[model samples]
Target chain A: MIPPRFHGVALAAGSAAGAVALAILGLWCAGFAPLAVITTWCAGAFGNGTRIALSLQEAGPLLLTGLATALAFRCGVLNVGGEGQFLAGAALFTAAALVLPVVGFALPLALGLGAAAGAAWAAIAAGLARWRGVPVVLSTILLNIIAVAVLGALVEGPLRDPATTAPQSALVADVFHLPVLVAGTRLHLGIVLAFVLAGVVWLVHERTSLGFEAKVIGLNPAAALRVGMPVAARQMQLLVASGAIAGLAGAAQVAGVTHFLSAATTSYGYAGIVVALLGRLHPVGIAAAALFMGLLDTGGRACEKQLGVPHELGDVVKGVMVLGVLIAAAWAARRSAAAHQGPADG
Target chain B: MAELVSGVAQSALTAAVPLLLAGTGELVAERAGVLNIGLEGLILAGCIGGFAGAVLGGTAGGLWLGVGGAVVAGMLVAGIFAVAVVYARVDQIVAGMAVNLLAFGAAGTIWHALQDAGRDSLPSGAGFDRIALGGPIVFDQYGLGWLALALVAVTGWMLAKTRAGLVLRALGEAPEACAVAGIDVLRWRFAAVLACGALAGLAGAYLSIMRTHSFAPDMSGGLGFLVLALVIFGRWRIGGLVVGCLGFGLIDAVQQQLQGAGAAGAVSYRLFQALPYLAALFALAVFRGRGNGPAQLGRPWPEER
Candidate 1:
């Protein structure tokens, strides 16, 4: 077997090469962007503390979103409705925020209880997948559509700020806002909480029976069933948990960063897919991926504000990197799967 | 009363055109087991390319040029995803989503900065001849509308009555078996996928050149995802694509009709907007049992077993 040191060096070189390739593709045919432009984009993303905090602030919700995606993916459940769940969380949290005078600190309690609310929203779609036997992919996407319309209705009608002439978002009560971690920075306690939860998830997956069952379920549902693991139940729980994490993503974004839910996606849940895949479903890997992507997120905004390179360069990179990484990760996993599985059945 | 029904039918068809083309293409795609989620983005790319082509040429020529542009754009995108997911064996869902993200990101920025700077999507004196068949037989739609209907029939025939169709089914059912049976797995699969991309692109182009007559940022909305859902609901069949589009299109038209039907306030209309997704969910519930899907769907080929 190859030494661990060799594996590290190889992996680093491979990821670097992949990154450079992603940058090139992002600049070239993906759009009519250039290399110096990409350099500027990176600089703007990580240039200073303010920018870095923006990255962190963005990373906070993204981490939760990433965790949700990985959690569902690991359990062999495809929770494509994370986006919808996220919106649901935002709506619920907003409703809580509005009722703060009556609810008091109880609003914060509800805001943090993303798991239950998010689970409920996600369960509706999961029911379609489990009971109805519709593909998770289709049902979740459909759920997203319904969720958007629902959100739009709330934002424009019932939940309208009453302060604005146009479709308006209500300002969240301070009591409902996530406690700040760093003064003068948008960096909220949510980042630390998100990481802690991600850590717990990783431990739960790597060190627990459920994790093994989840992996087995993912590897082969048929085999997993034969092994007496309840595949449907695990998938159901995983999806609900995924929804909760995704809901937390939305809640954190609104409470910590935006201080309100906007009509459009603040891009929390969607960006999580890239982080989850790039991290290869590992907790630490997710943090690193999120930071790297957080830089891109910041940088994309920078390019738009400064170089006039258009924020899309970052988007192109995000897409290429995620898609390319998925391909690479899949290939690597496939190569290792043979060796990894040999001991199991044998 | 009759006019109301006919008018709703016409508007529904208009909305269904792009969905028809994109859904038809997705039908070809998922049959081979690749769930392309980036359709929203792919259609956006087509909208951009199609608009550019239409602007460059005059009338009929520009229209056909737009089709060519869309096909090329489709190929360019479908080619990348196939390489990543098929060759590199990436997670198809995320890979496809990434493509969509990239496509969506670029279209607005590129159109405004690069293309519009050169007057790209702007109408350039040339466009389509609005066909006046002048009767209940076929009065409302332009020639492209008629062509879209023809495409549905043709694609259905190709899927059912052809050697290529058989190979696609065999590959979908069992790629390894198809390979063992001496079918060129990559070639047939790639052909199906690229065709999906091209048709999706054509659908996107149709939005700009035929129906709305211009390119707009992210104009396809979530229709790409809707079409994909319809594909699953339709069981990845060509006939299903047409029927699904009509069904969805009717929902959309009816949602708007709810305005005339005087169905409550703005809030209720928002709920009504959710009709397509809710319809799909209900349809899935009614179907209740899973059909035998493509045997090799979502299992990357030469994949680790």
Candidate 2:
């Protein structure tokens, strides 16, 4: 029998291999040489310090978003509103940055407000689910649309930069920017914070009672309730907390990358779901998945520029990876169940 | 004033075609115990495929060809989803989302390549001509819009009267019982999902060839999700679904008119654009806890060996 420790590694490796194969097949169908595309993707994602930094920079928001998704899923609350929550966070962050005077703690204050905004946004859906009998899944999707429209309205009207005709807010004050972590690279303190936060989340989920209760609620709500667990309240709190993390991701993007609220911001929230699932809903796993996704994003750009492939190839690759993981996990579960049954028959 | 009212009514019906089509399709799938959140992705696949087919078939009969291509493309994407959810028993929601990402990326890549090859423009005569019925504005509508209405009636009747519909709805309510009675639950679900894909594809084709006459990346927007919401708002009944679609469609038409008028000065048109979604959220909230969905909706059925 395979050791339990080795089983996880094997499953991950298998999923990765399957994903690469599927991606290559997709590229080949589009009339590209598989080997050449793979090589180009690799070089573009990690060949130089600048490329690595770019990849890591993209991974930062994904990490937070992934954590948000993971935390919610672990509590059995499918919080698909990460995209909306992220936008809410960025919008509020931008608003805070615009109003708050530049001070030593201005950055933290902006981020805090952004997180609060995200939490509030999530609470709306949670509250709806709790009191109004609306499903979180459906409410979150609708909320995403509303959030996008709100962001567009904000950027075009109230938040419009009068200095420019573009539909975006004014450039954030330089004082609020995330400090560069490395010289001559786009790396910033945000990515570092993302990693640190991932570690903290891991500790919370793995080493705490709250995390345990959340997991129990996820596994079987009826059983959890029978044991007198506060299923509804706990779910609401976890969902709100998830929203805060997604909001932090958005705030980080504003502080570290975009510097202004725009309608065309990267959709880290949607991509975070892929990351969370691929990471097996574990914090550490999510971090790794985020890094991989970041690589795909960076490499896809390189492929687009250097090999004439569309940058959306990265999304395809990520999609294939998640599908592969889901398939593999299911196959493994079936096999294990069969094996368990075999002993009884013997 | 009469002309303006008719115009708005006409526009509302036109806008509701895609929703009605996709929503009806999703309604069937949900009735058969499967929830496909990948409707957006399927619509996207149809968009690109329909555009390409129109461009390839040339002007004379290109629109019809485009519809066919869209159905095929949507089914192909849906087939991938069916295999994962039906055969592999993966989490339907997560799998559906993955399919969305896959379709979006694939469609974008294909679109870019087509543009690079200078085949980006649609044939001038690709869109459907308006059929004038000489009375109300609704009577003078695009062929596809009329067809969408016909489809809704046919679908509603079939669901209420047909044996196949009974089996499909039965599978959703109690798949194990059906299986015990020697029915193939998985096969029915697979077919139901494929049918949903075909209708969604047709809806997408309507967007490109009939409604807009052009394709853009992610053009279906959140219309797909709105369809899902409409199904719920309608209490999973055909009559309710139509009311939900028309209601949302009217809201959209009004928003468009408001935007065109620029009456709400200093308020960005985007706020108007958000009106339908806001209304959908409100509808869902108002109609909450009254979901009449299938008993086994979204639950994976394991085939007993």
| RMSD values, in order shown | 3.4, 1.8
For candidate 2, what is the interface RMSD? Answer: 1.0
| Candidate 1 runs further than 4 Å off | A1-39, A102-104, A333-346, B58-61, B115-121, B128-130, B260-264
CAPRI quality level assigned to candidate 2 from its DockQ score? high
- What TM-score, computed on C-alpha atoms, does each candidate reach? 0.91, 0.97
For candidate 1, write residues B203-233 as lDDT tens digits.
8887877777777775877778888777776
- Report how far off residue A208 is in candidate 2 (Å): 0.9
DockQ of each: 0.67, 0.81
Residue A50 in candidate 2 has what lDDT? 85
- Judged by DockQ cut-offs, the docking class of candidate 1 is medium
Best by DockQ: 2
For model 1, residues A1-346, the per-residue Cα lDDT tens digits are 6674444334433663576566556557645467666677768777777778888887887788889988988877777677888988888887777765645566567676655667788888788677777778767777887888888888888888888866657787777777887678889988888889988998888999999899889878999999799999999889988998898777777787878766776656777877787777778778877877777677777776775656665666667666656665566666677677886564
Residues A1-346 of candidate 2: C-alpha lDDT, one tens digit per residue: 7786656556766786777787778779978898888899899999888889999998999999999999999989999999999999999999999989999999999999999989999999999999998889888988988899899989988888999888999999998899987677667899989999999888888899998999999989999999999999999999999999999899989998889999885788999899899888988788888898888888888888887887776677777777888988888888877887886663
**Model 1: C-alpha RMSD to truth?**
3.4
